[model samples]
Target chain A: MGVNTEPDVLPEARVIAVAGLGLIGGSLARRLAECGRRVIAWNHRPAPYEQARAAGIECVDDVTDLARAVPDVLVLCTPLKAMPDVLAKLAPVLDSRTVLTDVGSVKGQVRDEVKAAGLNDLYVGAHPMAGNEFSGYAASDPSLYDDALWAVTFDECTSYDRLLVVIDMICEGVGDRIIAIDDDTHDQAAALISHMPHVVSTALANELAETPSRNIAQALAAGCWRDMTRVALTDPDRTRAMVEEDAANVAQLLHHMSDRLESMATLLESGDDEALAQVRDFFAVARPYREYKARERGGAAHESVTVRIGGDEASWRDQLLASAKRGEHIMHMTDRTHAIAEIRTALV
Target chain B: MGVNTEPDVLPEARVIAVAGLGLIGGSLARRLAECGRRVIAWNHRPAPYEQARAAGIECVDDVTDLARAVPDVLVLCTPLKAMPDVLAKLAPVLDSRTVLTDVGSVKGQVRDEVKAAGLNDLYVGAHPMAGNEFSGYAASDPSLYDDALWAVTFDECTSYDRLLVVIDMICEGVGDRIIAIDDDTHDQAAALISHMPHVVSTALANELAETPSRNIAQALAAGCWRDMTRVALTDPDRTRAMVEEDAANVAQLLHHMSDRLESMATLLESGDDEALAQVRDFFAVARPYREYKARERGGAAHESVTVRIGGDEASWRDQLLASAKRGEHIMHMTDRTHAIAEIRTALV
Candidate 1:
């Protein structure tokens, strides 16, 4: 994850084509337009085009015509399913100097789609981890990206100059916490956390529906139940598509989560106090990590780099072998007890 | 379950001995003191008694003075297991007219213990469904009980004259939404809604603790995760006690929940869109129940009789069954809805 190394501020793009005028597209357009960039908005349906135009935004109905405008940047804000076709529509008219990116949930497939559409040289897969329960232009807010993660998925063939430019744009919308993650890692990790949790919450709420005791359940559910099931109220078809499209990775995560739950159930059933104690200890250990993330929201924490490893035996061994690989080199490092340990190498 | 019946408000008692000066006890004492009743605070530990005394409240460290003080009401405000021993201590010198009630989470066990102690005629089982994440006397706020359910568990052979007094006391401490329920239904319903969800949330938080990608998971977790897992930080011993004592009922609920989740997983694995749509519809149907409950949280909403059922049957069935049964018929009439093809009957 790229957090350190001074931010590369690129000059503003002259003309930007946003391929979908929904939540992401509208928000991005509003922000960029406010910052004095000419944003050309496009939507499949004609409804959003008017809204975009009414807001003093440039609107284009045809992808080819929009592409023919030869904007300095092309931001594909369409849904995952529509991304490939959108790319294909613009591929023939694309300029080599134009930088391309998207605001999709999953990065792996988008990366593949970019390659298959022969736009690898132009496109940099950017997944801004920002959204609301609501979708569409009316619901969009420019501040939606204010202090959120914008994961710029990168591979060896990705243009470093274009990646930096996209990063600069993302940082402008959100804060300067631009993460550089491999496409696979970002997608798989997202599947484990965001995608799977949504499905679980929806399932729980769905199960309680039409049940005899649902009224009492509703009465008893405090802040906890509300938070746990809020995601259930979001559009199911959109979430379903994301999960099904990344079925294999999502399935793996589901299996892992299920196993964890099963173990917990076993401990509860057997009255295993020791196991329960261990679980409690785990929560205590994880508390700092959770608090760290909570605090990291709305602001950048540090200028430090995070190293990523693939999901393999080498990854496990690397975790053990890589001492302070988290951007910190040698120097006085604090141990678990908060005592400083002297190291020979220079610190990052 | 008791619904719309007029609560027999008891006359103000001369002296009330609160047998646990913790959050609920402290809050109750403050309310009673405010209502011009002299409350004798007793705590097994001396610290809270001192804290209570500092607030201009009378405190007692000894249990033997129950006979000497001869309070009209003896409130057992300890945990469920402690109730029996406290009752036994109070029994030796208890007055015949002395009414006893408890502030325990689980009602069925407390009812059984009160019966076994031969205090059935004098004992009333009460559960004020209100709380905060924090505990102890310092954390107590009298208004915490404002507009909350004060469920009074009763059965055959209970003195009607004494029941009114208990109901009035609860109404004064909390708002007058006094619900009369049987011990079995209270326990079972509570297991379904309160206890089971707490267990589920805690288990989920614990599951996430062990993941190598917990940092990523935590970062990706938005308002939904924070809201959902708020209950995961519950005091471990209290959680253990709840599940352990009510293991049978809680286990059944867990089984039901597990089955639901497993079925959902199966549906996802099979890629069944029709089943998924049905699941979504179920959640939509269940939305009104939660909304109604949310509406009733504050205001004159509490003045109306709210008859809530513990099972999955529609709201109409709950009303019909409550009306059809003898225990339910005696309750007062308030707001109403109709069940399918059910014969309409007036509340007695």
Candidate 2:
């Protein structure tokens, strides 16, 4: 309950502007509106306008109209490829009070685009860990954002006050959780978890495709192979774009995974007592993860805790990043100085 | 319809002995009885005996009791670790009229064990692509084998008549499909499609577990990461045993996968036009597989065909292996000379 000089800190995001109402934006806009926050949306196409309107989302034609509305937070829900043009359009019209954000998979790329557009002062990068194989406005559902964990990213130039505003929009307005982290950490983690795995899956599919007895191999393929290669079935163009956007991180992870596989191969080939023991070690290396998943299957419980943010800029940011690294998801802020988080990602 | 020279071919396995009443064996026992075949079963434990009787399956107290019954085909369904012991007990009492078979995952190793027990002459190697996560008779269901594809493996010493007996048990008694190939080919394909992928999944899980910001990466994980790592969450002890049994093939495939990943990593780091082209080619290399899956998803039809099996021993075995390599699943024996197979594993 220590709210003082930062009166604008999470002053309850009342009006929200959503530009580019695809599946993610459409779902976000609908949920925010359903949660009682006034929503103004604009899409590249008018196809979703009728249904969005029926769901109580007001639609506009021009992208700049969303900026002109001067909502508390204006989220650019366009694809990463379309971000530059959208940011270009909103550069002059976006009100200073409207904290800019996005639902892009990569944060650093989007932040750089925002900075290039001279809107870095009003920017807060975000990525919602929510989506299905299906996309477009028609496939969007308000519940898509239900209980979702979002990465709310920042950098040296990010305003603490603006971040609090976006935090309020996520935790309170959108009824979801957030982890406030730096842009680089968010991108690296995203690549580690998603992008690198996509490339691995693709490589597996390639292996099967290239095998001489492919038909025989495919015939004998079961749950393990099927599950590991499922993501390789996704649209390659889209996957390629996502990987290329975060090349360095994905490449680094690919190298690490290559080394692990090669090392395992060597041990399997050795056939000696020591090699066998090392093979045992290779599988045992993921013991922590296996235990965590087993506990998750057993419906492990989460503990809730509160985080205090009352210090200089660097220390405050460091505290938040540390909380995020510990896997504490900010559910909501009790006041500008305190945030309630749930310890759901605990490995042990 | 050439039946004169090989009268034992397609003679049919009316009475069956199942050694081990765990999930795979128990389900097979029940399914055979339900399909009107006399089913005799034995287990190291007697927990499933009473229940087995109720299901019309004759449960024997001792493993030797199974051989004493002189069933038409005796299936050693126990774990690989228990194979030698079970085989030794059956060796002396087993009837020469009985064709020996087992539903082991790896065929070459099992055949070696059977040879060591002096029962290789009667042995027929079989592996059903079935079973869920559950084990034990209580978790077994008759429908566990519904429409399953089984690999019916052989070697230089594999008698054609004994192979036919096992084929009769699988195709008619158990109502499944079969693909007869050499033991080495089966092991190679199994390693390619299943064992290697399991290790790769485990490697990915290890990466996540060892990450400094593991909690953060886990939080960001979605369907791609979850699916790719699903098998890694399997019991490590069991996974290690399976990998060790098929070490050479798995090791070779792991080496190939590592090379693919490392190549991609180099291209990703290069970031030049030529490097990007190579990166695109890396993803494009899987085009054959992606297209195959796309066709599979579209409910591609399987055309019926009859494969002839008559010639000198080596040529006939080669013909069958070629048929399996073409993904033809033998549905039933049309006669001593031909088999009805469905062209199901069509990759293109």
Candidate 3:
């Protein structure tokens, strides 16, 4: 097999190594390779080895091979629970010149682990706010991070210029927009936006599980329940691990959500016209705020055309992207169900 | 100047009078007209009168005119709060031959009102499970009730044959499927399937309204939050009226939801691995059940193509339906946002 050497088209002379070839790592490696960089990938499992080799990416059989490659940048893409063990094992192999970053959802725990391993000076935290229902190396796509927001948390002791260079390199390689914030702030924001929503969704689904008329109700469920509970379809083990790690934050947010739900229940139960009016006013404020936020986020601006194609969505997305002109892109694609797939594309 | 008389093409020699020319009333009138039936509509408001008249449906100025024109059937399409008053007003004018029905979401209250108005023998409760985000006469379409589920509840004292004939006429006029249910069961099912979901959606939107990072979170919100909160964009007064009328059922459901949410919070807070695994198992059951229900509902079977056409969605939907082939239909059409309208059509 032909090994992927560093290409001349790359502006900087930097070797990149990606550990744990899951969706994120695999996608990163694919994007970096496409950007004319030498990318070496390592995975504990053997399933991704053939695919990585077939993609012309060098596969390291052992963690020591990662240090032997002498990569200037090392990206850890392991699951949250596996991170500490992986970090500890690889700490001996990492050199001072190797700048480390991760694509974990939570930043605080990773930051603590890096500090505990005496690698704070070489570590920066990153979370690409991009994912789909599917996971693993087989589902990896080069354009997964295109135009996605990447949250980066930097340590005070780390060299600012060196970290910035590495961030810029990754951003350029994957076409991701950077959002710099502190680790705590990142966790707080993520709890509200991501983890909290997941808990709400899962809990809602669980509620439905116990309802007597759930089957009938599900038959009649419109867009609301479908959207609200979409995240419940994710891998239970993976989600369980994430929620366990961020249990404190998730629990706090769930408590807040419970308070809000209780308030609504109390208002409805009050049987007072004024309380009903108050509830109405509450929704009146909510309606415009939600709409405004949706509009502000460019959710309402797309001129999209959705068509049903019965096959692999990624393949169809790739086919469309290849032939699409400037300003044309897939706005959204639904998970395949009943041998049918829906793809919404925004036409310029 | 013209009055709608009996049309010969209709199988039954019946005149259908529809009171309240809002979305449901106007659409019913229009569809009845299209089905070669004489439809006379009466609206308390002046705005819809001209529109109804323009659509070739005769408009009545008063309740007496509706009684005079409605020799066979009188359908009450007024709001929940106005229903008792309207029924009392029209009760003085109606004869025993007239079959009375309504398009109300809550059936128990309407049944009570019908009984109080001494029209129980002539009344049959009907609630069509079809609606759009928009309302009023201007948003009405002839195909609004086509292939939609129409829940019909009957009182024990009512004339079965007469009510069935009227129900058949209405079903034939609008091409709706009949779902026979008791009034109380109808209310309970509707609360779970429709009203409760609406409340959940509104509360979620209210949560977003109170969030400090709402704008940022909304920017990152994927299909989950968007779908879950879509109903929050509806008219607040109409929703408030419904919620108030069905406050008891809604409050009970909300209390149940709160309990479920609290249980989840307690589990997560407990930080017990077994508890977390139980929560995960909860989701495992929920996810498959939801998917199975969605699949059983034919949610995954649609072969729809959505195109962005910037204009009035109702007008576009009407035009498409008017020219569509025997099996084709408009599955859905989204409201115009940022000057872009999306219409999804199913090619049979």
Candidate 4:
């Protein structure tokens, strides 16, 4: 099952079937189609199915119909909980050549399920670290994954070349930066970066909700509170679905975070003259780490080009889209004033 | 001494002496000067004094000189730890006619010190809920406190009318929204909105710093982490000084936050069938609270008007300042493409 180490071979343009046309799936499908790859989408829910169809995407209504389409690459973009069941249903139709992948938050569980279903050779677990507070098919954009980190996990026995062929196509199509790690490593990193942070944000939000003077406190809420709790605005059901798949990792990180908070409280409560100094030291160490992170993240492989334009509000918006299409990676457009607009483009 | 407050009587425009020309002090001084009020600034540090002097603000080198000026309103803008000593040194010269106030995060300590000095009637504790990550006199802007929340705490025996007169004067001068809370209430709110969150952010940053994959994680860090840890980038000395004054409240809130995190971790680790549902419910309650806060904040008394202009980058910046002066409350200007600019002004 080991992949052949062929550097120059690109995979053929076989039909790519995307299961679950939510934000990730819809965006991937749109991006792949835009890149001249044949993309067919499947959605269990009629709303997203209709959305995909309305967006000019070819939609397969049934699992059998999707399996019959015989896609060379099958991407499972369903929620974490739904992936196992979806995999079970699709397993019967998958062949050795049909490389299977997924865009789930936690990869360990999905990897285990794929192994249990005897599809390890065909599976490569992937998670693209790209999304917003908004979700679903309607919010999907073709460039959602542009310049974003995409973590892919491969087992030792997996066909690395074959998996890379598929991944490289998707990455190239969507302009994603590839980050290869094992399933366990990927899940651990996800806990650190995504899952634990979500829990922390929710806890902060919950505490604020329980405050008696929440109304007054809310009036006093500034940039710090807003930034700390922005992720708490996500759909509750979706967040639950995501967190549950990686519960143990999330819980472990939360426990560690709790310990950290307790230590800070203890230092503050010590009443020693040096207590403030200790607190100062704690933050002093953390400051550089955060600054380093910010600096490193900013230095990622993304080149931004700013373009200036002038127009009315509607015209500015229209010009923004036009510039985005022409540039192919416009990240955002700021309306400087009524007459001036700045379009920031991230070159692929 | 009770301040004689007659309904038709306005306090005479006496000199305003602002001590410690840091970010808050410098901005207040600039705003006061811009509002046609004579402002004299004092800074213990030579650099800030020089900066204030360079900014065309009147600076008093000595505390007695400031007192000799006989300011009707004296605003102490030093750090929390330095406030008591600064107040003690200036208490002898501050007569009953001069209404004394200090802008400090923790109001209880300042309130106690003022009472200890028998200057209760002449003292009001204030905490302006405004600042940027950038600090010092150099970062000060005349509009720093525009549309910002300013918490003012008055003791029970204080002359309410006189305090209100001084507060109204200061608030109007700085363009801050008045949120009158008691010492304890203000501290508690400050802990919830500012201090505890800083600890949480530092803890999170510390955890990342301790990770072996920190360098990689830093590379992969995105918006959520960026927002959550932004305040962690501030000067540790300043943060410690602020937190130490409000240590008890901050510690208590941090303990509460620890408990919340512990509970969330417990729920995640329980392996209950309803765990996902419970998590969903937890977040659902919090989402609306945060949304309400954001909506209310947005609805604060500020009307932003956008004006369009076209020019080169340097000329656009100049035009932005010119428009801001003409508009009187330009909150921000965006550089829309190279040709056009948008200036957003908040109407007074």
Candidate 5:
């Protein structure tokens, strides 16, 4: 099926107001500024305001200043708990023509809050599935949106043309393969894929920390351990808000995950080789399913690589002399402790 | 408490046999060759032998050749299941003074197998906590061993001086972080840190596969999914071996992990804000543990960074030109995309 490609090419945006200056807000501001929109950024704290200014962004320190900007598009990039009041305060500044969207984790709660505030005509919910372990404006990559899934939640009230304009603008920024779903389903799925994993990883990390094995685990942990528990290092406040806001769905999925792990444990405990073999068989069935979904996100199976480094700095210089004298692989020599270089030969 | 510094340095190895030519064996061969040892490499297949030959390694196609070579040290680098027979066959070659070690996961089983085969004095179990997803001789780097842990297992019959010589050899190949642990404790710890996480990641990927919302999930799954499910994509045969060999310990750890996740689900289902808060608090306590470990891994993290690309190959060259003409921060390029040669600049 062909994707809809119609662009709502409005002549200009009057003003674009961003609700926060975390990673998303900062990126959106930069992108809007690139598109020649007069961007006004708002942050509650003095910290991000300075960061915004350093980036040559025009900053509004207060909500009233944001209201005065009279944005044609008001993007809420605040944490979930902070979204309701920000939406409420922006309602008076917003009109039917003004477009609003959020970069929040849970869409259903935010969508309900927007509708409850009686600004349904001016609002939609969106989640840009891109992030780094690091937060704040410094970590915001312009290409963070590229190849990510920007899930736009729509109901009957969402204007077709307005959605197109927002989609085009997002595509111009850090764009990815976009998926459309309604608020409820989008929220439930987000809980399953995103929020639930965070909760699981954090809980696992916590269990590791609480065990006597924690000390030994630290020594034994490799890249796999680091990768598996990475989300455990996320800002607790941000994840707490996400879990609390979408408690029911996260709870449901967590139950399902727990049950699956429990079954796996039982099979392992029984020491029945056939049962354990079945666990591997089950994963074989699951692998292709995951591969299919990952492809939709424009990702492929990651390219595995091997790297070889030769010589310490002192030995490197000696190697350079040895290679030059012996006419070997060493070229363009530089001296440093453990020089960053790649192997030209299959050293092993 | 000071570690023993005056441990015996091994006499130059007159002959050495490596039973596999994957990451560990390839690396061992290279180091042994560099250390002036006569190294004979054997692989289960001939392809790695070809690559080893190209790298100037002496390759022997048959395991019987190992008996005639009569290597002073036999470092078995095969999978766990293949260890016992490889050890038994190598027994004919082992002299009274011969020191032996095997680079395998789950040291306890291998330790027992070697003892059962009447080579207790000659055998030591070693696990090098370093690897990439890629395998085989071509992917092997001599430097892959640098600055990683070599967990060495010691038992009642192990000679002090012989242990030190093996430890010295491993330290030279890898790093000086040679942790000495009993076989049982090592197996239990491996269960916690390595095997348990594999089960968790595989089950998680499986869970995501079965979810009705996978279509939306595929788009939204980012680094978290990639990180959590990495072990899911690991070689199934290797995974099965690790799981079966240490079934009891892995089962115990899985029970603990399942219980933690269950409680998290319960809290979410009951909408216990306080309990949810506690879960977040638990993460707060756990995040530092991982952060501390990351700091310890140090330069190993840099090993994974892709090379940066810039200049004429940039896709955003036109955009950069336009932004530069418009007096933006397009001149302040920092990070560059390696593949696309795109210079990422913050637009001021």
Candidate 6:
């Protein structure tokens, strides 16, 4: 076989290694430490080390020190672009006992980097659905992860035991919900929700920037415009990088979005009886989404269910993926055989 | 002449008439009453009459009675589609002493309706930039008008005296800011800021509804997605009506937006160094807006200025429009010849 998947046993995670103490990394390390996990953290810059140690997190000078410590779980909280270099550094010192994972926004490329670094056997993937517009260690807060949901991703060569350890870190340690799926699914879903929308928001702000009567238009702007363009105000370099990293998926979604807007323009420009009827239909197609939001706003509690994973080792992944597709979030693992989940975001 | 421009010495508005007790109308009537004006109101259904009267507003049986009272200003608070019928009802009874204005979202259409109803001479269009997701008198809030800016639109035959009376209602009676401009400019600015952005937001929601992995995608959604899609969850019928009212402007903007998104997709799909550079440029185009928003977040005081209106009656309108184009909100009128404005939304 081209890859190894021999390992099948990992102990419950009590110690976690966090690499790179940025906003996401710093918050996660602080949270894990607060959960009573021995969080060992390293930052490229030692600026946050003192504060991190004061939070009861152990500080390390080099990332290799994290690998040498051989914690139950090692989370690479470094930015996506920093993945390869950090992965390369950890490849030699990282013990097989440590299950590797990351909190990168994009999963497919991060997985490719892990494979390239010859650390695929130990790597699982994670992305916590938490953040504000703010960034850096100074903006990091343990409460950022409050009631957060995460996507735990895998691939063909992914170790089940490693996946279990990552799930332990997320569900038991971080006190969050998760959906286990493959890397490609994670990337595409992320593009649809986050990456592609960032491009659209930027396009909007760019259009306003080019408008001759921008100031007058902006004066008339209300909550709608503010909410729509809020993401565009984030660091452009960072947004560009995120969009570029998920290039193909974002491009595909953009094309779909472009077509949607073009067709709408045509319908509006026509301004005939039939076109007007079509425009109404254009708004109608989103009725399901609108209704879903209505229910969400109604504060209806999501119904909880138990999912029993069955079939072969391969089919267990499929079963969980299918459950996620049905809008279920695995809240906790009861055992190797079953997981408890909540139906959180289903649309009719 | 097609329209009349007579009566140059209209009195300050101490008496106000409000038609329709829906969200916008009810909120406005309550606010005017609280400001200690003699507020008379009419609604098609008297459902809100009890509550409105309790709030110190005078309830009327018919809209014509509002006109018969000869209030200093008669503010039509009905929805745009109801404008024609309401205007037709008030046309014969509306006293010449009453300056006419409507709080419609679209100005061009309302002006046309007023002209058709033979009430153009009495009309001075006004639209308050205030509302919430909820509707009806139940959700009517006096604080809705708190620090609100209004667009007071004019036309070729718009009476200068009538404009001053309407300005009195908005400034002194309602305690708000105003920007006096022509109908088409007001319509276009509203389209640029509100109507067109509503279409874009709905399109985003529609796109998400159609995505195969929608639930999975939505699971990954956080603040950016939530804020961007919030407006789409509002009543689609209302959104559709607003978009249709400004079809031409909204269509043109959608085309520009579509092109922007498509070009970014092409640059991303190319995935070369030059293409990447272009992608960076795409994000960079919005830097001015970013900096503007940053400065706004810093909460620096907006520099205030006094604009002197001169060069004949026609040129007075031009002077105020020019001030508005420079991102000024006319806070209070110092005199007929001078207005005090704040530099609130300048882009560069």
Best of the candidates, DockQ? 2
In order of listing, the candidates' clash counts read: 13, 0, 0, 17, 1, 0
Model 5: residues with Cα > 4 Å off, grouped in runs = A1-15, A37-72, A130-143, A146-148, A156-165, A168-177, A290-348, B1-15, B38-71, B91-93, B172-176, B294-348
In angstroms, how far off is B220's CA in candidate 6? 0.7
Candidate 1 or 3, higher DockQ? Answer: 1
Give lDDT tens digits, candidate 2, residues B1-348. Answer: 111135644677888999999999999999999999999999999999999999999988899998888888889889999998888888999878888889999988899999999998888899999999999999999999999999998888888877777888899999999999989999999998898999999999999888888999999999898999999988899999999999999999999999999998999999999999988888898888888888888999998999988735757798898898888999999876699999998775
lDDT of 4 by residue, A226-246 (tens): 888888876656667677788
Q: Native contacts recovered, in order, as a fraction for each?
A: 0.22, 0.87, 0.45, 0.58, 0.58, 0.88
What is the CAPRI rating of model 4's predicted complex?
Answer: acceptable
Pairing residues by index, what is the TM-score of model 3?
0.76
Residue pairs in candidate 6 whose N, alpha carbon or C atoms collide under 3 angstroms: none
Candidate 2 A-chain TM-score: 0.96
What TM-score, over all chains together, does every model reach?
A: 0.77, 0.97, 0.76, 0.78, 0.74, 0.93
Superposed on all Cα atoms, the candidates' RMSDs to the truth, in angstroms, are 8.2, 2.3, 14.1, 14.6, 19.8, 3.2
The TM-score-based order of candidates, best leading, equals: 2, 6, 4, 1, 3, 5
Model 5's CAPRI class?
incorrect
Tens digit of lDDT per residue, candidate 3, span B161-225?
A: 44444545555566664444457556765676667767777777777667654544454456666
lDDT of 1 by residue, A1-348 (tens): 111224333334567778888998898888778777677878888787766776667987687777777776789998887887888888888877678888887887888899999999787787776777778998988888776666666675775556655655665433434445567666766766667666667656655564554544444455656667777665566666776667656666556555555554556667667966754553464454444445445454454333332223334224312322232211111221111211211112
Error of 3 at B72 (Å): 3.6
Interface CA RMSD, all predictions? 6.2, 0.9, 8.6, 8.7, 14.7, 0.9
All candidates' lDDT scores? Answer: 0.62, 0.89, 0.66, 0.68, 0.64, 0.87
- Pairs clashing in candidate 5? A145-A174
Pitting candidate 1 against candidate 5, the one with the higher lDDT is 5
**lDDT value for candidate 5?**
0.64
Winner on DockQ (2 vs 5):
2
Q: For model 2, what is the alpha-carbon lDDT of residue A292?
A: 81
Q: Could you tell me the TM-score of chain A in candidate 3?
A: 0.76
Global CA lDDT of candidate 3, please? 0.66
